[model samples]
Target: MTATNLLPRNRRPADGPSPGSARTKRRRRPGLMLTLGLTGLGLLVVLAVVAPWIWGDRAEELGPSVHLGSSGEHWLGTDALGRDIFARTMVATRLTLELSALATLIASTVGITLGTLIWVSGPRIRAVGLRVIDVMISYPAVILALAIAAILDPGPKACVIAIGAAGSPSFARLTANLAASVAGRDFVGSARLLGVGPLRLMRRHILPNIAEPLLVLLSVSYAHTLMALSGLSFLGLGVQLPDYDWGQLLAGGLQSLYTNPVEAVGPAVAIVLAGLSASFVGDGLAAAANRSRRADAPAKATKPAEANAAAAVGTAPAVPDDAVLVVDDLRVLRKDGTALVDGVSFHIGAAEIVGVVGESGSGKSLTAMAAARLLPGGLHATARTAELRHPDSAALDLVAPGAENAETRRRLAVEIGIVYQDPSASFNPALKLGGQLTETLRVHLKASRREAREQAIEQLDFVRLTDPASRLRQYPHELSGGMRQRAMIAAALLTRPRLIIADEPTTALDVTVQAEVLRLLRAANERDGTAMLFISHDIAVVGDLCDRVLVMYAGRLVEELTAEDVREGRARHPYTQALLAATPRLDTAAAAPAESAGGPEASAGEPASAEPVRTLAAIPGRPPQPDERPPGCAFAPRCPQVLAACHDTPPPVHSPAPGLSVLCHLEQAGARTGETGTDKPLEAAR
Candidate 1:
């Protein structure tokens, strides 16, 4: 997708700014330093354009008295050649700024282009490029420029080239590192998996995300370039004789320093002022960028009554069909044909919350991404059927041949929203929260600026975000983790899509914020009947919020049970039982031994050796890797109740109770006879 799809256009309405827009600008006003820096830069540019024309004649005219000190007639005295020192300094502004500006442009263009190319290239090329940058930067920029200047004829053109080439290595190194960091972010990966072209991805996502740091670096480079050019001119290798700069003026004044001290002071002061101007501008831009990184403070903590009031909902809106999403025999395979997610099948009904629970690397998120056709590059997904049904369109088979075209992807985007695990990485750091949130409305619904803003505010308020309108002016980094997640929820629900694939959405949040997010999600589902494919590793969280839970281990589903079944100790799989046992309990008093009910006095009579020592339960061993999985059940090695037959044979899926499926040898064996195996009792822990 193009940036215009998410960013606001510059079109002005005949009716003027919308009510929301009229109240506040898209972003807050620039800080005092930024304003001052901009003002100084503007003034310098004006002087560069007009100074030579206004003072050229006077600067060339010989004064009656040579080597004159500061006086009423001569503010900065006269040089040895009887030229006006102040006029000469003023006249040199154009040439000085011209050389530096051109040099900066060359450095930025070459450096940024090389750095971006390095980031996008293969590992070998990137390694070579990084080494090249290091080698170039090892030489001091001024020394390198001096060598280049000595090789070329002394002139302005040569000076610009030398300085520009000397400055490029630093820019290149910084750009490469910045681009690499941004390219691996979740948002960038999402855009790529969604079929955004490489060029568009770089332009719309990577560049914008990295622009702030590049801008600050550019300003600093310009200042350095100006200094380098001035030094070259002072050494008689730049600007030549006729075309003078501050450096040449200083050169001439230094010859008669004792007699005409003010002459050198004039040029020296001008150079210092110019350098200060660039420094101020760079500092200002850096401060602004830092503010973007440290976004607005989080909203006040949510009160219990307020949370309850916000979560309250009436009857849920009726959905068009029962099942919002359905997948059968789903598999996500790497290019080498190793299955990351193998044979995962499930369905989500209207307004139902289906949680996929697993340990790390168990393919919980892979399955969800496969269902949405958002698997990363180098990985392809296939299934017998992967169908998505939205109220706005007919059913779409995401895994069907030629189903990944622009139109199909657009439809998929409109129908499904994804809430990624890291809220910070889910957004474009350069864009405001409002623009990113309202992008769906503007692109999919063709909403007007005013309409989108109003609806965005409403959604933000619904998610319990305080100062909803003000938040529209803030950037992503300005908010706290909880606030950003809430905004992310608002962004997802803005279009009211049929399904929201929340991939571990609450993993980064603290307990209090996690609870609030769960409430908000539950409320959204209840009010809109939106189906959710909630993916998380936290069994307690899944058990609390989900209607049905699918437990996965080592790229395969091991068990399926209802929320009540998970809570009431009815899980049939050994892996699921182990996960339950590993969960820590909060109520120590309740879990305390019955013998200790009379406290220390009652326990005093008992032998100290008879006292029970409690320890937190933990599962032994780790889940198997995808490619290195055992021949039979993937979890067989980790299963505590592993049998000899289980080592050589894959377990068959068996339904011992209504709506419960277990992939276990015991379950399969139980189905052969009248006996049904008993599941270990589990405590209901939140």
Candidate 2:
């Protein structure tokens, strides 16, 4: 009853950028120069389209004065034949644009189709296509165009055919490469599992995402087509003389160069303008598309306190001396400077298994990824302090730019191994198992091929993956799910890393397989004295495997306790308590409904209104979305013990017991010792 809701009526991130965060929102404003260029192109296109009616043939016939300069009668002056250059240029644009459009159309249609086929094809066919494209790319486009033109009567039709043929292979190659990358993404894999047909996925998801790229390619390719058309015509295999296309005009001007040079330069200028216009317009569309995608991204907010982070973070706890990894005041912010992981601090000791547990979207994975220095693309992570110490090496400050130090980052990259949720996607399908697994040893250990091979097989067998020798030869897709995971762990072991960060590595496996993988992980830690940070939403597994556990809620670390406390369900936080209650119990039958007025007596004579409404207790609503997250305690809205200050002030981490920390106002109520009843001992940077 004491909890208050101070959130605005319509929930959204508060307006204006936070100080020093340099937050930038992507704007949908169109590019002014691009608009003008496109407008110019539009006018040229209209001239081409309406040339027959708008442009007068009266000026097409030869006039009395040949090679005359600009006058009232002739705007662009007289050509060598005394024909009006303005009229000739207008008609030439019609022919030039038509040829370019036709060639591009033919090329794009054939290219996209062939590319899709190549992308969807089996390895053998795809390899063949790639080779053929490579050969085509190496061969000169001009020679190919010339040969086709000579073979097909050396005319306009032949020129168009040659241009299309020359352009198709390039487009096919681009589309095939882009399609392969897009198809490999997680969302596309999800779509496939949902029974969405390949064609539907291509048309609906893949094409829409790649639309901007394809259009830019089309525009740039259109310019190429235009140049090719003019070149072939200028070489006499294209539009004939007296036809006076831009190329022919250029060709005709050579003899008169000393007298009137504009004839030659005029067509060159036109071509350059058209090429630039096309490129500018295409670039604008790509920018606009990029903005649209960013706009569609889910809204995220960095708490306002982050603007005054130095004062706000007034922290607690220090990284233990035995700590192999120490992260102080870590934050992961969105492009808009919204915090995904805010002011999270923790450490992992040598040879210790630490569990980071949270519901989905609680920033568990984000924090882990940041600590590993592998935040996903577009997400930026920073820390007030970060120092990773290896027993044999100096401490590496991860807060520094990755390139600022040479040896430290290279060493850390090899020393900290990672196991992902989906093992199959981690390995490249094109690589053999042995080659991929042995690659880690070759990189970090600098082991030779034979030595790496031996180690890889030995590690694979250690993980209990049967037929280690056979798995080494097989491709990733050839292995079963469990085999793939075990193989992944095998690869990680090859590094002999001091620390392994497993981010829900068992989530995608069957229960039996999951147990086997978890066993392997435990065996790794026990046998090698390797520290492991296991992240998962399954509290039971965390309890069974971890020495200590950290609980995250709404991007903040809310509680830290021993794994023994987790197994005993002795959590002090209401959110964790609710999570425990909601987990289904299989050792006993489900509890019966609560008694309603002692049953029989109530049914006999009691009014219906007198009967109590007996319903199972459930958490009332969903976790607040990113934009709607509470200003104070993120969990306060749902917390049964929420206090008055819980609605207005964020809580700081405090030690409730030895090696135990909780971020809750209730946990700190009795311990407020400093000014404003909100201060705590600051966490040490080291």
Candidate 3:
């Protein structure tokens, strides 16, 4: 059930596909239904356009014999007026098609506007709009059409108006739901963080993503409107004298069904065929769109920078003294006052890579997001100081209410860049790589298209992506995971911001790709002097890439130490020690000494008393949820060296050495008593 058990099972992969199994996923051609649907609609449109011209005169001609049965000259019999039923049916196509098309257009326009209104409105307005739509939808489409038609004169115009109005509610409801779903995606959130205005965001991101579904809905609405219009005409409220549709022909034929059934049968066949054409098109388009989206998505299913100068403890500095971002006492809380990130603060100096290492739900990502003012709705952040300091200008207060004006946000857009974990999800699927890459440049930097494109290519090349020009033309799904991440990095560095908040940017990558990403991040920092807040649960990665490492536990900073200190086993907090032990190393088995009569003997070339090989250790118990955290120390229940006081009282910050701070009761006492905390391991101290 665990990964270990599953790993060995997949050791020897299948040499090839089993007899019936496919080796490669076959790309399906357009569905037969889609082809048939398009073909049927094409034939219908041709009939609508040319049938009236070819059969108009003959259809209105009075035959010598009325209600005649099928014959060589007059097929499917004649109507009471002695007109050819087949000719009449063919001629009715023009009127029926035009009315349906016009009505569908009207429904789509009104529905889309109302849907957008509901989507972007405040809660009260949205609620009211939805209620009205629900009430309108409660009545059957035909019933609504009848009521509207009765209010107006009985004619084609009234029928069109009635059907279109009746169908708007369904379209509106579909559009609103689709828009809401698309708006919740991460790409939309990323665009918002980049300071894209609401209208632009909706147009460029939201509407485009929902466009295909709306198109499918358009076809369906056409079909529904066509049926409703036909019903109205059958009831004598549509296509009055001198104009005839399939419904009018059906109405007249029904009165003489017993005399000559062909009159009723012919018109009924035409109506069914026309309705089927629209329904088939809608269903086929929907299927094609779904397949295309599936193909565009992966084959497999699956922030602002804040600067705070003050460290976790007074004696130890989490960031360099010359900090670019200084956030003090940052707290991100839910609407109900639950603290997700409580009193957590850190800073990043220019060109420094400060890594935040912690287990999931430790508020690592939340802290970075809060500082950038990118927290999700219903969660607000407050900080005593979230100041972005530049050498040339006064510090900008990022946390102050009403301070984030258009100018401030525009400045932040240029000053802070965020690299998200899943690059594919962060990039807009509906847009080409080049457009998304150049958007920030055009919007925030006021660069022309040519200039933005030039800069985008340069940045893409800087991130070591090959064929940068060609990649620009491709969509996000067209690139490999590593390539997409590189493109994301390029986008982040395109504006050459002062700070980059990489929230586990390399978490989803393979080891080799992860190394490449880390290298690129380091190179960017060294070359551009762009500070970064790198967040990851991988301690080894943090040690490899960061100048300083911050260990967060639960929702607070449990320890702050230099990457060197962490590498040298000088971490004072028990959580940090456990994290270090959990990191898998190739040398773990090699360093393990052999068992002997006396005890475990040191391996050859090792000291007489070799240290025990540390097997990977999982920290027992999951991190507490925000509301479930203990009143005292959040990690007290899980800490190995927990003292009695740790259950009732919070641990005090301890400065064991310069540039090293931890929150632990033992360390605090040791610091106060002038004890050298690093002389013994955490277990020995306990």
Candidate 4:
């Protein structure tokens, strides 16, 4: 079956971040130094911006002659022209800093925009743009600045343009490379499928994730711009005379270096300090932001609350009742023309959750993504035939043999929404949550501006985010991990989609949050009758969430049964049986004493007590690789139940009942014998 058809339709509200957490962790090394540096920089900036008013005519006044040494009248003595070095230094520092800041801003804005455009544009456009940027970078920046300065009037504007142009190529390349890499992430694909258009996607999703690197580049480039401006001013090709620029001061001081080296050293020190401060602040912020992100990472493994909630959600729905999604003969082919998913088929009913469980590399997630028409890059479904069934209409073939068209895909997107594993990576960090949420509503629902905004806020509320309206104004980073995932769900629900594909949605979250999210999803499904195709590596989670389960092995469906059937020890396929045995059971005898133990005895029991450990029987070997399939059965090599005929011929799919199916030679043989399939022993199959 097609992967897109694997997911069911149901979506819960978006979750927000943890409350009362510090905005970010404190910076570690150089914290005090960084603070001082920033403070000094801020003071310098203030002096520069207000230098005209503060220094005024006094800046141009020639102080007492014989300006060497710190006299009471002239601090740090005076320059060759007898201008007060203290005043000139302050004014010069201001002008030079201004020039650098403007140049840096211009360079960053132009470069990042161009880079992102190239990254997202068609391949031919990106190729051409990259080549142009490469050619620009080939020229020495200083030489280019010199030529440009000579062509234009040498002043602040000229310096700004020169430095900005010189820096553009580097920033462009950096931004483009970063954007391209982020675009390839699964979250980007999720955003696109969420109805985020290219422009909004770049602004909202692409920009935020790339901001930290861009900020670092901005700081480093600011230092470069300052130096470049100084070079041009020293050469008399930047900041005109009487402007009191540091570069000009330095050039003036050069003539009298022997008489007063302090003149040169004074302005030189200011320049160095400015650059150092910028670098320090950038480093500090970057480190702090990174630490904050790491600390905020959701906990792994299921939490007690989440497990309890899953258990409280009740039983899985019976199958063949109201199939929400259906797949037939779905196949994914490699570039070498080999099939990965080979003729897989399955079905999920309304308000029903279907679990696709498999060992690593078993094409589980691949099958689920295909159901959403979201296969990995360059991997196409060669022969897909799938459908999504709704209460009001006939089943829609998502991948009809010859009917893979844009309209069909759009229809599927409007009806089916997918939530991926990584929530942080999924959102556009640059954009506020409100904008991202509104975009989804506008696109699929054609919601008006006011209506979209209102709906966006409402959707946030649906996800249980407190103060949803205010949260909308905040950016993705402002929210916690769980909150981001919740926002993703809110965006998905804006479409009122009938089917939701949750591909390991809770994998990245802490157990507590994962439980909340699972409860929310179950509520959405049961209350709204939206079907869901829930995919996960954790069989235990599947057993808790899904009503029916489809076990996949090496790209093919190995078994299909109700969750109850699997729990009650009715799994027919050997792979399915192994998966059931592998689930961790908390209620087992091993868990009872551990729960009751206390103090020193409990600690001692943890080390030596076997207590009938509820051990999972792990499958012995790695699952079969796509390129290396066994003849009769994919599991034969790993199967403890292997027989001679299993290696030579493929097993027939056996359906003991209307809704259950298994592919095993043993089951077929047992049926062939006069024995009932129920009497077949697990060891005999192994």
On residues 1-686, what C-alpha lDDT tens digit does candidate 2 reach at each position? 00011121232354575554544333323476568668878987987887756665754787788887667887666776788776777778888888888989888888888887876676678879878887886877677788889889877788899988888887888777777666654334423422345577677556655666788788878878888888998888998755657777777666677897655666777777787777777777766654122212334454444432321234536667788888878888777666777787878898899999888998898887777666554577888777778877788776576433435545665677778788766565545777767755665467899999888889999998888888889977788778898987887777778888898998887566777788899999988888888998877788788999988887878888888887666776666665554444442232222234356643556455442332223454566655456668888777655679888777766686888887767676863322210111111100
- lDDT for position 272 in model 3: 79
* Candidate 2 worst ten-residue window by lDDT: 677-686
- Cα lDDT for residue 626, candidate 2: 51
- How high is each candidate's TM-score? 0.69, 0.57, 0.85, 0.73
Worst 10 residues of 4 by lDDT: 306-315
**lDDT of model 4 at position 107:** 88
Tens-digit lDDT track of model 4 for 1-686: 11211233335576544454443223336576568668978888888888777766666886567547667877767876677787788777767887898989988889988998887786689889999999998998888889888899988898889888888898998887777667766667867666556787788677877788788778778877888899899999898876758888888778778877777877788878887888777776666555222212222332122111111101122336577777766777655555667767776777778888887777778777777766654466743346777777676765544454555646666788777788877666666777767765566566798999888787778888779889989978888788888887877777777888888888898666777777777877876678888888776677677898888888778778887776665777777767766665554655656556664566564645444434456667787666667667888887756768788677777777877777788875663322212223333433
**What is the C-alpha local distance difference test score of candidate 2?**
0.71
Name every residue pair that clashes in candidate 3.
Answer: 304-372, 307-325, 307-326, 307-327, 308-325, 308-326, 308-327
Q: Name the regions of candidate 3 deviating beyond 4 angstroms.
A: 1-30, 122-124, 127-140, 290-321, 592-608, 666-686
Candidate 3 lowest-lDDT run of ten: 1-10
Q: What is the per-residue lDDT of model 1 for residues 529-608, given as tens digits with 9 covering 90 to 100?
A: 89999988778778888999999987887788898887664677877877776655443334367555877677777765
Which of 2 and 4 is ahead in TM-score? Answer: 4
So what's the TM-score on candidate 3? Answer: 0.85
Residue 59 in candidate 2, Cα distance off native in Å: 40
**What are the lDDT scores of the predictions, listed in order?**
0.77, 0.71, 0.78, 0.72
- Which is better, 3 or 4, measured by TM-score? 3
Best by TM-score: 3
